[model samples]
Target chain A: MDKDTLLDCHRRISPHIHRTPVFSSRSLNRMAGADMVFKCENFQRGGSFKPRGAVNAILCLTEEQQEKGVVTHSSGNFAQALSLAAGRIGVQAYIVMPSNAPQVKKNAVMEYGGEIIECDPTLAARESEAARIVKETGATFIHPSNDMDVIVGQGTACLELLEEEQNLHYVVAPVGGGGLIAGTALAAYYFGKGCAVVGGEPIAVDDAYRSLKSGKIESNKTTDTIADGLKTQLGDKNFPILQKHVESIVRVTESEIIEAMRLIWERMKIVVEPSSAVALAAVLKEREKFENQKVGIILSGGNVDFRFKGRP
Target chain B: MDKDTLLDCHRRISPHIHRTPVFSSRSLNRMAGADMVFKCENFQRGGSFKPRGAVNAILCLTEEQQEKGVVTHSSGNFAQALSLAAGRIGVQAYIVMPSNAPQVKKNAVMEYGGEIIECDPTLAARESEAARIVKETGATFIHPSNDMDVIVGQGTACLELLEEEQNLHYVVAPVGGGGLIAGTALAAYYFGKGCAVVGGEPIAVDDAYRSLKSGKIESNKTTDTIADGLKTQLGDKNFPILQKHVESIVRVTESEIIEAMRLIWERMKIVVEPSSAVALAAVLKEREKFENQKVGIILSGGNVDFRFKGRP
Candidate 1:
């Protein structure tokens, strides 16, 4: 997608989303040995950047299409994002999740007024069910990351950061389904003076990191990372964007992500989930390289169940 | 004690402290059935509103007095606040704490350049130690909540909240040493258009509530509450201020505080300590009273040991 389309998508979704705040920490700056601005998408509507894409996709649809509604299959933030975004604009959202998905996740979707269709716990089952729903109800199936409108919409966050701090040397985001980082890369390419876009991913599921090297989509054999959000593989639509515009991917360990997450929670006084911490972990891991440089980090989301671990 | 002093304190301390953001939560508003604005002093410099008072008190000192330095005895947010505030003004801070105080609290004070003087864990021991330090070094003793300058400094948070939204019906804050609520009461009295200021206290340490009722200072029989910050009884200076301008104090159970804390952490994506949650808990307890009205809450601090509770 071009910058013009990205700008247009930002305009379309601007009225629906929060222009999330960019928070700076002197203590965190001392730790990272760099000047860093955190774009707190954890405070975004639906508690993640997922709503940026979900809202854009829904808004781009025709009146007839909106009435038919939209559908997506996910067991994470996107489920709530689609539900909340669709509900905001007077559209019905069909969220397809694994039957074994946690009750908290199901409850959040329900709270957002989404209709949940539970399928067997498999990728094939999820895709097939989504397809069946699209066929039966004439609902549009919006992929969590791969769609063009969604990617452009997700780019608006980086657009905002760049607009706020135009002199940023680099922009970083955690690579989940490649939506946030892909869009971020494009925003930096178009708006930044010479800013490079970096992706942070868990070493346990370094599909995006490997995919860039392989010049193709790569899958993880094991999803053993604590950052559960980054387990998904990169998509065909966003992979080319990432490969062409993105600079590199930084891999961090589970313990490192947790440590970074704790630092942000303690110092910044903000609650960010594990996925968001990966980007800060990447910065902390390579502190010397970023010394005295201005960097922007997208805190992807803050939607974790507090019952298992009292603070989210 | 008056609007002029509070306004002067705000002006003097504004350069040293953060004008922390006021955040609103739709989920919280829905739950309370009212419009609530949270003055996020949890995100304030030093991770609490203590610095507002600390900085103002230090700055109000004469040049010679500042040169002599300042001292306080505490094992909580005040210890760090004094250290950081004094450090910012290039003054020495003597922080006397019980030997049994948490090592993390000690480290934070040290990080802020406070010289820690270890004393016994008793209140008498703390006061005697602080007295001895002042007697020897001639350092000005600054009470955490009992001083005139400090009370005026603490009032600035409410001043800012009122300045931002002048039509608030009620302002609520967790009462520790009664400084924040007392200041809030004065600010509301002088600035708010018919605004009523309320204090929230832990049922475990309902000294302020009893003090207000009995028209005299009262001690807590047991500091059984999880809100460690509110364990202190109202001092002579702030108690009278609280009695005069404060409407009433609301007492919340431990479980209620935890529930309110969780709702904020879950929905607002902000980290607030149990003490900060007390105010919101009080509001939730009296939901009908605040229904359809505009309310402001001071989130006192975000300084909590997550290592013990995993997350707060």
Candidate 2:
């Protein structure tokens, strides 16, 4: 993607994304060995940073494209985000999920007026059904990642975070499909390249970490972690941007993820999903590099079910 | 207290108390027969409106009073708030809590650097233990409600709500020790008496509702509800204020509390403790009076464990 185009994406979707608050934590700072400023994307609309990219994807569609609707295969935050943002902007959204997706996510999509299409759990089954839905309905396919518009939307987080604190010495976020980090890095490149943009991951699904290190998108055959949102493979679009821009990739254990989640809840008193816990895990896991530096951690999402463990 | 003192508190603690956002749900409107604006006190500092009173109580202490440290007996939120706020300003905090209080609350007190002295469930045991702790430690007792400073702190929420939207039609909140209602009534008195203040209670602990009817503080023989915070009888200081300021009281069943909690988490996407649910439950149960009018329901706290039954 061209620099000017990325800048235009930032400009076009400016009003849609929430300029979430930057919170200071004396307790976290003392604990993490750094002065910490948390950009509260956990409080974002649809309860995650997906709205940025979801809106970007919907907004980029030709007027005719949005009218026909958009389809994606996500059982969680992405489904809810697409349904909500698309619904807000008068775009119909078709959510494709496995038949056994959580009732909560299903109810959320329906509440937002998203059309649901069920498939078996295999990727093959989902892709075939998603293809059929698009062909029959004439809807555009808004891949959760691997799309330019969505990448730009996710980048707005960096734009908003940078807008709040321009001189931050470091920026950290968890990496999954890399849409968020890619966008974050783009925003940091234009507004804050003087600062470091780092990525975090659970060692269980270290695809993003390995991909950034090896200069290729990587995948885990069978991932295992309690953070359902971080199970996706790095997208082709996301991998390049991350390989070039993300300063470092840190891996945290499952224990670290749970510990970080609890620690953040105890101190910050905010309801953060485990994906958001990843960025916090990085800061807590790698304390030496953060000492005395003004660090920014993007709490990417807060869509975790308090009642049930989401990951398989 | 004088009008100037109460008004002064409104100004002093304005920045500290989150003018908590008011959320409305069209779906909830359909169910409750009103366009409801839920004031999210669950999002407040220390996860309840208790901090407003706790902070106010701590801030108003004389230099001599401050040196003595602050002591309070609370089963939950007040303990956490007193611990958190008092510790922040370098004031020593001692909390007396029943041994049966949730693990989360115990964690909060310790996290806030409070010294917790466990006591039996009975008020007699709690009071004696608290007095003993205060005398031994040379601490000043900051009663959770039956005190002017706590009432003043609780009043700040009403002040902010009224200040933001002066013509609000009805205000509702759960009745515990009546600190919140006492504060709210005073705030509502200054803006508009035409706006009715509704106190909500669970049937299991309907003491406040009965007290308002009998023209005296009432006590429950035994309390049974997930809303542990709302199980207390009205205090001497707060009941009179409730009598003078409140317009009416409403009661909800135990099941309604769970349903109300689910409504908040599902629709507004906010995690509210069971105590916060009672206010919403009142509006939900008595759908007629609130219908079409602008109503404000304070989601007083979010410290409840969001556990579904059958969880380990």
Candidate 3:
């Protein structure tokens, strides 16, 4: 997608999404030895940046498609996002979630006026359930991260970040289904002066890292990382954008992810999911490259089930 | 204390403290049945609003006193605040923390360059140790929440809140040792058009609530509340201000405190200590009083030792 596409997508979704604030901590800067600006999508609607894409995707649909409603298969932040976005837009959302999905996740979707269709805890079951819903209700199947509209919508986060921080030397984002990093790369490539885009991936599920090295989209052998959101493989639609605009993909271990997540929560005083911490983990893991430079990191989401095991 | 005292105190500490941002969530507004604004002292330096008072107290000290350094007997946020504030202002801080205080807290104090002198956890023991240190080193003993300078400094948070939310109908704060609520009451009295101040106290240690009715400072029989920061009783210094300007005091149960804390973490996506949640809990408990009215709540701090029981 081009600059106009991103701008138009942002304009369409602006009214529906929160223009979340950017946060920075001197202690975090000292730890990383760099001037860092964090775009906190953790505070975004549905507790993640997923709504940026979900809203834009739903809004871009044809009148007939909008009438038919939207459907998606996710047990994560995207389900809540799509549900909330659709509810706000006066469109019905059918979320096909695994029966084993957390009750909190189900409640969140239902709270946002989404109808949940439960299936077995497998990709095929989820896909089949979503397909059945689409066929039965004439619903538009909205991919969480692999669609053009979603990518353009997701890019708007980086677009807004760049608008506020014009001189950022590098922009970092977690590479999950590749929508966010791809969109981020495009935003940096077009809107930034010379900002480089980088992706942070879990070592356990290093599909994006392997894909970059192999010059093709690669699949993970196992999805065993603490960063649950980064387990999905890259898609063909966003892979080309990453290859063209992304500077590199950095892989962090599970412990590194937990450490980074804890540091952000403790130091920044904000709740962030482990997936979001991967970007900061990547930065701290390879501190030399970003030392003394202005870097921007996208804290993807904060939909974590945190239990304070202190006095209470 | 008056408006100018708070204004001047804010000016003095402005260079050393963070003018932490105000946060709100639509979901929270819906739950409380009021348009609520959260003065996020949780994001304040030292993870609490203590620094505002700590820095102001230190800056108000005489040149000779500053040279002699500062001492405080506490094992809470104030210790960290005093340590960090002193380190930033190039003054030595002698923190007389209880030997049983969390190791993490001690580490934080040391990281901020404070010299810690451990003592027995009892009140008398802490007092004697602090007194001995003051006699030995001539260090000024800064009370955590009972001094006039600290009261004025703490009032700056409410002052800043009022500055942003000019038409708030009421401002709520945790009672604690009475510094924050008393200062908040004073700020609302002077600066707000007609804003009333409210105090949120833990039901288990409802000394502040009882003191208001009895017209005397009262001590708690048992400090069994989950809101560890609010266990202390109101002090003589701040009791008069609370009686004069505070409209009412609302007590919340431990369950309510935990429920409120979880709501903030789950819906608002911010980490807040249980004491911080008490303000919001009070607001929710007294929802009918604040129905459709604009309310401001000062989230006291975010230093809770949170553990994520979810995956990773």
Candidate 4:
């Protein structure tokens, strides 16, 4: 994407995304042997950073397209983000989600007035449902990650992150469909820090890592882990962007993801979803390489369903 | 406090305190039976509303007094708030805490550059330790909840809460030493809400409630409950303020406190320390009174010890 488009995208959606706090992690820093700066996207609007892109994409649609409404297939943060953003603009949002998606997430989408269509978890079923919704409702299919506008909108978060501190050695984000990490990579590379951007994924669903290694997009057979937000196969528009920008993709074990989640909540006192923890988990596994390096991490969301009774 | 000083306190400290998010909980609204407007002071700097008064008090200090430094006695949010606020002004802070105070809180005080002295938990011990620190160092002793500047400073939170949306029928806060509730009462009352500010306290440490009923401050023989923050006697300063401004104090059972904390984390998806949950528990108990009424609640802090997993 051109610099002008990126700049305009920032202007288009500045009000919707939260300028979430950047917290210092003394414990995580010591463990990773790096100076850690946490960009708390977990605190962002709609409990994640998706609103940044959703707002930009929805607002930029032509009047005719706006009249047609918007449609997307997401069961988690994007569903709520797009629905909430669309709700604010007096536009309807039709969300297609796998029937197995968590109730809490579906409830949030409904709360924001998003019309939900249930589908099977398989890619073919999800795509078919989304296409049917678009055809039946005459709503524009707003791709959660694949659209250039959405990706650039996601890029604005890094703009804000670098605006505070531009000299980071590494920037990291948990990769779902590669939109956040790809956009984050573009900002980190453009912000001029000799910066390297890393995509963090679970070993259970390491499509991004496999894709990077094989020099092509890849998919996982099934997903397992507490971070449901990162289970999606890489999107078409985001795959090329990911290959072009991201330095590497790291896979973290399930146990390591939980440990990282607990550490972020306990030590940093910031609320983050398990997916966000993957970035920190990746950093912790390679302490030697990151030692004392200035690293910026994006905590992707805070929408956990468990009731932590303050005890194990 | 005079009206001009109250107005000035709002202006002087507006930059320091974050006007945190107000989350709308439909279920909480249905359950609490009120249109709940949750004022998230748990997101406040110093992880609570303590900094409002501390910053105001520090700013009220004269040039000579500011240079001499500040001191307070507590094992809770007060110690950290005072240290951070005083440190910001390049003033040395000498905090005295009971020897049995949590090591984590003591470490936070030290991390903020406060000179910590350990004493017993009693007010007599606190006074002696603080007096010695002040006597030796010539620093100004800022009481946690008693001073006028501090009270007015704490009032700003309510002022903003009311100003944001004025249909508030009741304002509820967790009462420990009574700094926040007292300040809330003054602000809510002064704002012409004709609203009564209620206090929510843990049943195990119901000194604040007993003290309010007896028309005097009371102390527990031995503090109980996992809510380490609220195990305290009402202050000489806070007691009179409570008597003048407070409507009534409600005691919450420990189980209710834990249940409310879980509900907040699970549904609202926010992390809160236990003391904050007392306000929620109180609202839950008196759900009928709040139904359909605009209710305001303060989430007091997020500074929780690892031992408690940051909740009760």
Candidate 5:
């Protein structure tokens, strides 16, 4: 939407979300040969940046609308984020998940006070179930990454980062459904002194990268990436914002994402999911452009399952 | 060692080590049922609190001794810490490692500019090689946990913590060779308003707990615990310090340590070695003693290798 909307969203959600710390490592700096400031949303409420948008979206609704509660169809960080955020604001949350969703993910959602509505293991089933709940309960449907309120809310992380370090030359974030990068791009455009926004996408699910070249929405033929969070395709609501203000997107290999994730876990001593690593991997892959520049990286989430080998 | 020595050590090592952040989580606070503040030395230089002691010991050396450098017998965090500390002070470091030591550990030492001397897997061989190196090069020998200067240096972490939150009711640390817990006990006794010091020990290798009961330095019959950093026997230098000032040692099972470590990784979103988890495990095991109290827990280190199941 507008800068005012994003700033207002930040103000609304500030009390509910963490102004997560920015971390740096000397060895990591030496390895990338760049000055990197990481905005650790891994430490954010619900272990991800999703709560920023969820809280803002819920808070934006009128008391009457809020009284009706909210509904979302997802089995990822947003599910947990929405549940936690809604719980924090005293609003009921209905989370529709596929039957095949991992029990751990469902457990996390339940822990956050979300009412789980299990459907058949299919996208159509999830959406239809969520629609039925919304219809029955008069609950507002909040799309994970495609709502204007959510995008504005997500932008607050970048706003906080730029406020801390105004001289950053670039802000980098991993592109999944494009919400984070889009919000990051807008935050940089309005608040940053001269910062550019870059998106890192896994090559296996490079919808955002392809969309940038095609000048339209793109879809993935096969979602096979270690960064499970980035497997979702970009949606219409955030794509226009991404197209107008975002810089070029960089694609990284699965091996590179793993290497970057390991480096972060080893060097920075912070646990970040593989999706978060994609942004750092992009910077390492294209170090020449960012050499000696102060770059801010948005570590999107840290909700990883140690049981799974990858992409849980 | 006294309070003045610890204060001086803090000043000496202030420029070299990081004043790591204190982190708290709502879920963790609920789990422990206490106001737990984590002193994250896992984020310290050399990826652990070991550097605090290593640097102080190296700096305490005479100019002549510093010129010849320092030597230590270990294949753990101490080896890497000594090398990095010596390199920082422009001194040579000789590291005596068991032949069975992992290559990754050796590589870390080399990366920090330590000259590695391979020895038989036995502790006697490690000590003899270190002795030979000392004789040949006139390098001062520094025990990982037994030296006075190192003990005082290790106490600096508690100094910083108490300085930040003076109202802490107790300070807890994982008891290894009695260095961290001993130093922590002294810091709490002198600097803390009325804080007591508690030590966490593994049930498999409950040397510290047994030592506290027997009033003597006790050795582990079998060091089969996952908290490998704490398997070493308490030395004469630190044991007395631990005996006089420490409150009590709480023993936790290996499963408890893993559960605590997982909670920290999942909820706190920090990567800590299994040794570091022992303190939190102890806290969880004895929740009544710390109920509603302001407790400070020192996360000793974050130098874990993911390749092995444990104790890398």
Candidate 6:
């Protein structure tokens, strides 16, 4: 997409999303030996940046499509985002979630007024259930990350970050379904003076890293990472954007992800999911390239399941 | 302290402390049944509002006292704040922490360049150890929450809050050593137009409530609360301020505090210590009294020791 397209999408979704704040920690800077600015999407509505895309995709839909409602299959932040976005826009949202999904996730979607359609705990089952709902209710199916409108909407976060801190040398984002990284790359390419885009991926599910090396979208053989959100493979729509704009993809191990997540929570005093920590892990893993440079990292989400207990 | 005293303290400590942001949540507002603004001191330097007081206390010290260094007996946020504040101001800090204090806390104190002297866990031992250190080294002793300089410093948080949201109907703070609440009460009295001050005390250690009723300083028979930072009793210096200006004290049970803390983590996506949640818990417990009113709650700190593990 061009600059106007991204700018237009941002303007369209401005009223529906939060311009989440940018946070920095001296301890974190010392640890990485880099000047880092964290764009905290953990503070965004639905506790993630998914709302940017979900709202944009829904808002871009035709009146007829809007009236028919929107449907998606996700047991993660996207479900909550779509549900909340649709509810706010006075549109119905049908979330097809696996029956084995966490009850808290289900409750969150329902709290946002989304109707949950349960299916078997598999991609085939989820997709089939979503298709069935679309046929039965004339609902429009919105891919969590594959859709272009969603990608453009997701780019607005980086747009907001760059607007506030224009001199960032590099912009980093976690590679999930590739939407966030692709959108971030596009934003940096167009708006950033000379900012290079980078992706942080889990070594267990390094599809984006492999995809970039192979010059095509790649699939993951196993999704066995603590960063659960980054398990999905890249799609055709966003793959090309990553290929064109993204400079490199850095892979981090599970321990590295966990350590980074803990550091952010302990040092920054903010709750962030493991997927969001992947970016910081990547930066710390390869600090020499980023040392003494101003870098921006997107904390993609904060929907962590933490149990509060009595002090030890 | 009057308005000018508070103002001057804020200005003096302004360069050293953060003008922490005020956060609001629709979900929390809905639950509390009042429009609430959270003055997030949890995001402050040293992960608490203790720096405002620690820095002010250090800065107010005479040139000779600063040269001799500062000393305090604590194993909490104040220890870290004092260490960090002293380090920043180029003064030596001798922190008399109990030998049984958490290793992580000790590491934090050393990381901020504070020298730690181990003492027994009892209050008497802590005081004696601190006094011995003072005698041995001639270091100026700074109380965690008792001294007038520290109290005025702590009040600057409420002053910053009032500056941003002047029309708040009431300001609520957790009463521990009484410094935070006393400062908040004075800030509201001077800066807010008819704004009332409220204290949120743990039901398990409701010394503040009892003291307010008895018209004298009172001690807790048993300091058994999940909010570890708030286990101490109010001091004479701050107790008088609380008695004169605080409108009421609301006590919240352990369960209510846990629930409020969980809500902030789950919905607000910020890591707040249990003591910070006490203010919100009190407001939710007394919802009818604050119905449709604008309330300000100071989230006291976010230095929680949470163990991050694999997802269930």
Quick one: best lDDT, which candidate? Answer: 6
Please give, for residues A176-212, the per-residue lDDT of candidate 4 as tens digits: 8888987887777677478899888999999989988
Docking class of 2: acceptable
Pitting candidate 2 against candidate 6, the one with the higher lDDT is 6
Which prediction has more favorable TM-score, 2 or 4? 2
With candidate 3 superimposed using the best TM-score fit, by how many Å does residue B178's alpha carbon deviate from the native?
1.2
TM-score against native, each model: 0.98, 0.89, 0.96, 0.76, 0.96, 0.97
TM-score winner between 1 and 6, please give it. 1
Q: Can you write out model 4's per-residue Cα lDDT over B49-111, one digit (the tens) per residue?
A: 889999999999999998889989988899999998887767889899999988888987888
Worst 10 residues of 2 chain B by lDDT: B303-312
lDDT of 3 by residue, A1-312 (tens): 577998899899999999999999999999999999999999888889999999999999998899999999998989999999999999999999999999989999999999999999999999999999989999999999999889888998899999999999999999999999988998999999899998999999999999999998899989898888989988989999999999999999988898899889888889899999999999999999999999999999999885646544
lDDT of 6 by residue, B230-261 (tens): 89998878888888899999999999999888
- Chain A TM-score for each of the predictions: 0.97, 0.95, 0.98, 0.95, 0.97, 0.98
Model 5: per-residue Cα lDDT over A114-194, one tens digit each? 999999978888889998999999999999999888888889999999989999999999999888988898899999987
Give the alpha carbon lDDT tens digit for every residue of A135-242 in model 2: 999999888877878988888887777877888889998888778888888888888849889989889999887776777777886668877788998887778788
TM-score of 1: 0.98
lDDT of 4 at B255: 83
DockQ of each: 0.57, 0.25, 0.57, 0.24, 0.50, 0.67
> Which stretches of candidate 6 lie above 4 Å from their native place?
A309-312, B309-312
The full ranking of all candidates by TM-score, starting with the best, is 1, 6, 5, 3, 2, 4
True-structure RMSD, every candidate: 1.6, 3.6, 1.9, 5.3, 2.5, 1.6
Candidate 5 lDDT over residue span B115-204, tens digit each: 999999998999999999999999999999998888888888899999999999999999998888878888998999989999999999
Q: Which prediction has more favorable DockQ, 3 or 6?
A: 6
Q: Is the docking of candidate 1 incorrect, acceptable, medium or high quality?
A: medium
Scored against the native two-chain complex, candidate 4 gets a DockQ of 0.24
The model with the greater lDDT, 5 or 6, is: 6
Error of 2 at A165 (Å): 1.2
The model with the greatest TM-score is 1
Candidate 3 residue pairs in clash (backbone atoms < 3 Å): none
Error of 2 at A211 (Å): 2.1
